[model samples]
Structures are given as structure tokens and as C-alpha cells.
Target chain A: MTIRYPNGKKYVPVRTSKSQKLKNPSFSNRGKSLEDELNESNDYYLSRGIAVIHKKPVPVQVVKVSYPARSAARITEAYFGTPSTTDYNGVWKGIYVDFEAKETKIKTSFPLNNIKEHQIQHMQNVTNAGGFAFLIIKFTTLERYFIVPFEMVERKWDRMKAGGRKSITLLEFENTSVEVQPGYIPRLDYLNAVETLMKLYDDKIER
Target chain B: MTIRYPNGKKYVPVRTSKSQKLKNPSFSNRGKSLEDELNESNDYYLSRGIAVIHKKPVPVQVVKVSYPARSAARITEAYFGTPSTTDYNGVWKGIYVDFEAKETKIKTSFPLNNIKEHQIQHMQNVTNAGGFAFLIIKFTTLERYFIVPFEMVERKWDRMKAGGRKSITLLEFENTSVEVQPGYIPRLDYLNAVETLMKLYDDKIER
Candidate 1:
């Protein structure tokens, strides 16, 4: 039941070593999967009646299957299908919250290639629909996470297409994005940053 | 791959034949899949900048896979996983929209067994979050569709569990639920029915 990445790399669940944990107890979950942490945070929010966000399941096209005696049916042939939207979405304080999360080992910059074109378009649609859309990006090496609103990302995305840098520098990300500090129970509490964006939206409406 | 229902019945994509088409021009998509129609309607809304609804992909647990070519990889073994949430959700008119769609061939009543317990709980969660949640049910035999809000459905669900009727009669459904007349371009035109519910919500808020 091993799942590999599309690039043929073995999908390993990152775990902090005992020595590393001892060295930095605060960042014990430094190398762990951002997706897993986000799922945990979502569960925490759901339990506390905070939000109802969920990660969309991976799309696959099944071509063949088999049924063994006294066993469950198994798909024998399938291929990954392109997703039409972003990863996570739900209702937060009666607001539609839509977002995508990604982690990169590189410390200097976050590559735009990590994101797909359709996902960007989907975020734009969410924004146009008056939904809160953003990206939760994690720098694995730096053990930092930030929430970048769709508007900011769209500006940089458009810039990249017009003979600009292929990636967003760490300096630029730190300046434009809201830094989300990791926590024990929720793991990655990005909602706090969402509240800030909510205030900004409210203020805009007031003006 | 061939898919089968939990009851061991093969999953067949319903299609309207020439004879059926000739019989009912309005119900031209009589036997076609409801999921496909919903997808088309979602696409229509997306293109027109109306709403941003999407169907969540079916979750599958991959057990084994093989790389046949340098670029193409095939899943050799997998199994369908139970979904944690409903099939479709998005933002509509600054409101969180969540729903599950089902089609039944029975003419008299709609079976409660068509929906799982978790799905009911999920819909309740959506409602509690101040989001719009409902079911798009199609009675295939009569070619009739209805949007049953979670509150009404929840009452019936609780009643069934307390030794009440195991199914909702067509008479009850027609009276309680919002009837959605099918259209040409979007096909389902369920949003029009949604507007009725929206008005009811707005009136309640004013009071």
C-alpha cells in the first residue's frame, strides 16, 4: 500500500528523530507532512465547532479491477486525473473558505511550478464569488509557515508569466504573507491568519 | 474498471434510448446520470461567473502500482474508501453551498438507505456553520427532482431511526421539498430552486 509521488520518488512520511526532537522541541514536527498537519488542524477546528474544512480526495480513473474470493474488490488498473479545484474548502464564520497548501524543502524561494494553472484559476473564481481564498505554504528547512491571500499570489503569478522570476523569494513571501505559528493541538493554526484577512475584508466593506 | 454497489449490483451508467427520447422530449435526459448533469450545471455556473461548485473525487486507497513507461504509471491494486463528506460543495452568492445528489428508480417513495449516517451528520455540521446544505434527489421513474433542505431531512432521518417510516413518500416530498424543473443548458437548474430557499432565509434574518 505504498504511495509514490508522480515524480517516481517514494512517498515517505517524515518523522523527527529523537536527537532532532531534543535539539528543538518547539519544531519537533518540522519535517512532517504539511497536508497531515493541515488535516489535523481541520479536525481540531471541526471538533471545537470552529470550521468544517476538508481536503478533496485525489481523482483517479479506474480502467480495470478484480474480485478475489472472500476479499474486497481491487482496482487493477488506474491513472491519476487532473483536479479541477484547490485542496481545502469549507465554511468559517459563515464565510466560504477555500485554500491550497504546499511545502517546499528549498529555503530561498517558493517555485511557482509547484502550483497548477487550473488551481490558480479556481482561486480567482473563489475570490470573485466573495469567498476567502488563500495558500498555506510551509518552508520545510526553515520550519516556517505562512498564509498568502489569493490576491497577492495572483499578482506574483501574473508577474512570473511576464518575464519575471519563476519563483517567489523567501524575503518577498515573508513580507507579503501572514506568518502562522505552529501549535500543539491544532498543529498548524492558519485560521488566526484567516481572521486577520477577514478583518481586512470587513474594513474594506465599511470604507 | 467495473464498479458494483454494496448490494453486488453492477454500476451501470443510465442512458436514454431513442424510444425513451421520443416519448418525453422534456425528460430527454431521463436515464442519464444525475452526477453528469450536476457537473455540467456546475461548469455552466463557473463559465457564467454565477457560482463555484465542484464534485469531490471518489476516495481510493492504492495498494500497489507499476510504472509502465517513463511518464505513465498504472495503479495495479486499489480499493474504494468511504468518503468523509458529501460529493459537492462551493460558494454561491456569498454563501457556503453543500449538497449530496442521488437518483432512485422507485416511483412511490425515496429510501433512507440511499444516504449514509455520516453524510447526514456532515450536512448537519454544514447547517450549524450557517451554510446552505441540502440534497438534490431525483425520482427517475417520474422524472421529478427536489431540493430537500437539511432541516427537513434531519427531522425525517431522526423519525426513521425512532421506528418511523423508512422512506419518504412522494406526496410528502412534493409538499415539503422545493421542486426543481429541469432546463436545457444547465439541465438541472437547481439554483433557481436554491433562490427560493435563499429568500426564505433572508426573510427569517430580517425577523
Candidate 2:
């Protein structure tokens, strides 16, 4: 069975290949998708009682459905709806946390076009409302993930809108964004970066 | 077009009656559903820069989909998945706000069975994390709405689990819950109740 979005893009299930499986028998999810890793990390966070965060489900506008059984209704026609906010959001340490995660194959630069204008506006609103807002960008080729604060993104977005570079280069991203190392159990330990950013934000407020 | 959930309930769009329409031509959504009212109130809140809240989209597990055109793909088979958390959550005045909304026709008492165990647990978790968590209960017959804090519900849930009454009486609810009157523009001005709760919470913390 296969699932496709309204845009006709096939939804590929995250799975390990036979060759990769054979090479790394002990590590099954070594090459799993970014979403899978983040989900595992969130589960780890929840289990340990550290934080409660969840990825918002993909919004779908269902037009038709059929009830074959009392407990099994099948959606026959649905259209994907545009998300008004980011993908992930939850409460952390008495504060609201909101962010969007994206992966790119390009190693040179992270394209700003990957994020929508409404998302940036939403992040701005969150920040203004005294919540933590950021982006989790993953460079698939380099296998590196970084937490880019909304302020950094806002600056870059404004620069781009003012006829500057459309994308932030690898060096610029490395300097501005906080890199998060992947781990075995949690997979992507992004909260450490959040903790660091929170301290920095607090320090700035004090100054 | 009709959409059915896995529980065999058809999704009905909220519509005003012909008589209601004729009686109040100025008021378009006079007899809209609870969900519709909530959505409109959320929109009002967002537009006014008061808060940012959204109802989580219904989660569905898609089994099969077909692409009829490049721009449009239709889900042929899917099933509704159980939500792990409440329907609505967002940031308000630098605090995390989370709540579940339910409507009941029973005028004497509100049934505890309307709320799931996981939802109760989730609300507990939110409150523990220093976030605001509550339930918006609407008694359809009485045409009254109340914001019942998780602490109140938790107390009742515990007593019920210990072999007490399975429902909370209307008098008890009236005494414990913060009543919120319905309005025309926002329909359900829930945040007014939230504001009062916040002050009470702050006062308790100060003490």
C-alpha cells in the first residue's frame, strides 16, 4: 500500500535497505529519515519526563469516506491542507516551544524558500508572545543538524527580501546556528541546543 | 460529500436553520456548532494579537492513495487514529495553554466518560509542566459553557476511580467551574475565562 499527498508526491515509508541492513546489523535505523529520528527523540523526551513535544499531524480535508465496518471507516477522498503554523510545538519548562524541521541534500547552502512566508510570520508572533521559536535544519549530505533561532532566520529573511542572497551559506549557518549531535537512544538531541539558546536569550534580556 | 470517522460517526457541517436565518439576518453564525464557534474565537484571538491557539487536525493513517492528476491526489483508504493529546493548544501571554472542548446534552450532570484517560493524563502533564490546562464544557440544554481547570477534573477523576459517582453534578460544576458566556463576534470568548484563571494562578503562586 502507498499513500500520496494532494500534490501527487508519494509518501515513502522510512525503511532500511537490505545492503545497509547487512552492513550494519546492530544499528537498524542508521539511515532513517529525519522525521523518524525526531519522533524517536520526542518519545525519549516524553518517556524520561524531560519535555512534552509532538509533531502536528498532516492536515487533510476529507471530502468523502465509507464505513465498511463499525470500527473501520475508510477515507475515499481527501485533499491536503496548507499548515498555518510550524510542524512541531509543545510546552517546555513553563514556556511554549514551536519549530519547523526540514532536510536538504544541498551541502553548500540552506535555501530560504524551504520555509514559507506565513511560517516566518508565525515564528515572529511566537517570539513576540515570549515563546521560543526556531528551525531544525538537517544537511542530509553531511549528516548534520542545527537549531537556527528565529532571530537569525528573521534577519536573513529580511536581508533576502531586501535583495540580498536567497540562501544562507554553509559557513554562515555554521556560525549562526547551534549544531546538535545525534545520539543512539534519542537519535537527535535538539533540546540541548534549546537549553543553550534559552540561556543566551535570558542573558540578552539581562543585558 | 460526507466524511466518516473510524467510530462510525459522520462529520456534519454546522448550519443555521431557515427560521433562525430569517429571525436574525444580521447574525450569520447564530446556531453554529461548538467546534465552529471555537474556531471563530481562535481566529478572533489571533487577529487581535491576544493569543495563538489552534485545533490539532484529525490524525488519519493513510493506507492507499491514487494520483488522478499532477496537482491532485486522492486518498482511497485511510483510518482515523486516536489523538494522543487534546484538540486545542497554543501560547498565551508567555504561557502554554492546552485544553479539550466537549459538549453534552445531559443537564443534570456532566459524564466523566466523555473524557478519555490519556487526555486526563495529558492535562496533568501540562499542568505539571507549569502550563495552563483545562476543559471547556458546554451543556447544550442549558446553553451554558464553563472552563473547568484540570485540578478540578483531576480531583473528580480520582474520586470516581476510587468508586465514587461517575459524573459531576451541574451544581458542583457551577460552583467549581468558571462560567463563560457566549458572544456574537467571537462566539465563545474563552480567553476572558483564561485571563481570570491566570490571575488566580498568579495569586496562588504569590501566596
Candidate 3:
């Protein structure tokens, strides 16, 4: 049986045998999207009084709406709008936290084009304004997750703009970014990585 | 001539004589909605590098979309979803800021029903997380704007839930909230009011 998502993409099922799943328990969450994983993790965080982060709703331009029924107003004509900000943002430990989540199947490098120019600009602005901004990138094929700080992203972005490598290699990620471990309760434990990054920056400033 | 909006509400044009406008210059922005005022103010704040605040886009649930052309994907069926969070949120001076903007035509009191239970919960959660949360309320009839801190709002909410008055009176707002004077550049100078509220709370904490 074949299934398709609303975006017209094929929904490929993760075919892991029971024995294989037992060996690789992380494969159990292979079918979930990056967004779903983040949302579930955010929910767990909120419930545990750890953090309060939320993913902003997808933007849409409504041209026409109809009062089909008294209770339900139906939107008839609309189009998606280009988002001006990052996907997820909120407060964590009295500090403003902002990040964009991206997942790529390629294990070699994550393409710079995966993030929009405005999003980079937004992250820079947030960071400049003394807020904590970072990128939560998932290399799906490698099952690796990393939280790259805005300063690192800015340096890479400047390099990309100045005709440097158009992608950040997996080796570069391993060296620069903090890798997140997958977990059961929160799924992707990215906040732990974030805390490590924060401490690393704090130590740098002290030095 | 009658102008009707997409929502079937009549667009009431503010009729002001040139002499009246010259005497009271703020009357020029009488017709602008509270949302328009805030968006313009946010843009001004962004450009001046004062703060990074943004109004979240209206939430919509798209049911069916058609690829009419190769470029433009048209949404044919959708519905407006009840927003889970407040309208405006961003970072200010490394502190997370979150607030809801509401305008009421009632002169006597701002109705408690204007706010949802979940919204109050969200604000409380943000405040508990050490982020600042508040409401920017405009009494349209009185042409008065005030920034009421989430603490005050929580007290009122509890009072209302415990069989007190169903609404907060204008007198109560005058006593407890910080009034915002509208300006030509930012339109509504609510951030100044927010800063005042912050200091006030800080002093209370010190005491």
C-alpha cells in the first residue's frame, strides 16, 4: 500500500524488522518528521517546567473567506506567505531562544540553501540583540543532530556569500557544532546541546 | 458610499475636518486598526534597533490546495484555527517578551471574555519561565491604551473566576496599568509603558 502526504510527497515507511528495531531502538522514531519530534520535545519540556518554546504557525494570505455556515467560516482563496522569522522561538532559563530546524538526507554536507536569507538575517538580528539564536540541523541518514550557534552560522553564511563552500561538511559540524543525543521522553535532546554551547561561549568570553 | 470589509464589517471612515485635524493631529490615525498600528510600530522599532518584536501571522488550517500553475499553489479549502499563543512575542534586551494586543469599544470595562483560558495559561507559563508577559489593551471608545502586566491580569483572572466582576473597569486600568501615549513614528508607544511596568515590578521584588 502506498500513501501520500498533503504536500504531494510519498510517505516512505521505515521498514525495520522487530529484531532490527530491538538492536537500533532510535530507528523507532525514524518515521516522525523533524517538526513532530521538536513539538513533542517542546511539550515534554513545558510539562517538566524546563522551557516554554513554541513553533509559530505556518503563514497564509487569505484573499477570500466565506460564511458557509453560521458557526464555521471557511476560507476559499488563500496563498502561503514567506515567513520572515525562524520556525521555533521562546524563553529558556530567562534567555530568549530562537532557532530554525532543518533535516537533510545527505550525510556529507548540509546545503546552505536549506535556510532562507531572511531567516539568517532574523537569526543575526536576534543574536545581536543579546538573544540566543541557533540552528537545530538533523542529518537524517546519519541519524545525527547538531545545534550550531548563530555566531558559527553567521561565519559560515558570510563565507557562503563570499563564494566559499556552499555547504557545511559533516566533519565541520562535528568539530564546530554540539551534537544532540536522541532520547525516549523528549526524542531529540537538543536543549542539552544548547546548554553546552552556552557554557562554551561563556568560557570563551571569560578567557 | 459604503465600503465593506472581507469579514462583512462596514469600514467606517473617520470624517475629520482639516481644522479639527490640525487641532488634534492624532485624529489622523483614527481609522487605522490596532493591528496596523502595532505592525507599523514594530517596523519602526526594528529599523531603529530598539527591539525585535513581531506579530505572529494568523493561524489557518489548509484542507485542500491545488497547483493551478507551476509556481503558485492556491489554497481552495481552509479554516482559521484558534491561535494557541498570543499575537506578539520577541526578544528585548536579552529578555523574552510576550504579549497579546486587544482593543475594545466598551467604555466602562474591558470584558474578561475577550481573553481565552488557554491564552492566560500560556502567559502564566511564559512569566513562570522568567520571560515578561503582558497585555496591550486599547479602549477604542476612550482612545486610551494601557500595558497591563501579566501579574495584574492573573489577579483579575482569579478574581473573575472566583465570582467577582466579569470585566476590568477603566478605573482599575487607570490605577494599575501603565498608559501608553500614541506617537507619530511608532503610533502606539507601548514599549515605553512596558519598560515602566518592568521597573515597577523590579521595585516590588526589591521591596
Among the numbered candidates, top DockQ falls to: 3
Model 1 agreement with the true structure over A17-136: per-residue lDDT tens digits: 765553333545744588889999999989988889999988999898789899888888898888989989998767888999998878899999999999999998987876888999
Docking model 1 quality class: medium
TM-score of chain A of 3: 0.85
Candidate 2 vs candidate 3, TM-score winner: 3
Look at candidate 2 and tell me the lDDT of residue A93.
69
Could you tell me which residue pairs clash in candidate 2? none
lDDT by residue for model 2 (A67-155), tens: 88666787888877889999999986677889999988788999999999999989888877667899999887677789888898899
User: Candidate 2, B97: how far from true, in Å?
Assistant: 0.3
Candidate 3 C-alpha error for residue B43, in Å:
0.6
Which residue ranges in model 3 land beyond 4 Å of their true spot?
A1-26, A202-207, B1-26, B203-207
Give one digit per residue, the lDDT tens place, for model 3 in A58-125.
99999999996566999999999999999999987777889999998787999999989999989878
Candidate 1, superposed: residue stretches over 4 Å from native:
A1-27, A201-207, B1-27, B201-207
lDDT of 1: 0.84
Each model's iRMS: 2.3, 2.5, 2.9
Number of backbone collisions per candidate, in order? 1, 0, 0
Candidate 3 per-residue C-alpha lDDT over B1-207 given as tens digits, one digit per residue, 9 for 90 to 100: 878999999997554476544323355565577889899999887887777899998889999999975769999999999887899999876778899999897888999999999899999888778789999998876778899988888899999999998999999999999999888998987888888888887432221
Q: After superposition, how far is residue A114 of candidate 2 from its true place, in Å?
A: 0.7
Quick one: best lDDT, which candidate? 3
* DockQ pick, better of 1 and 2: 1
> How accurately is candidate 2 docked according to DockQ?
0.45
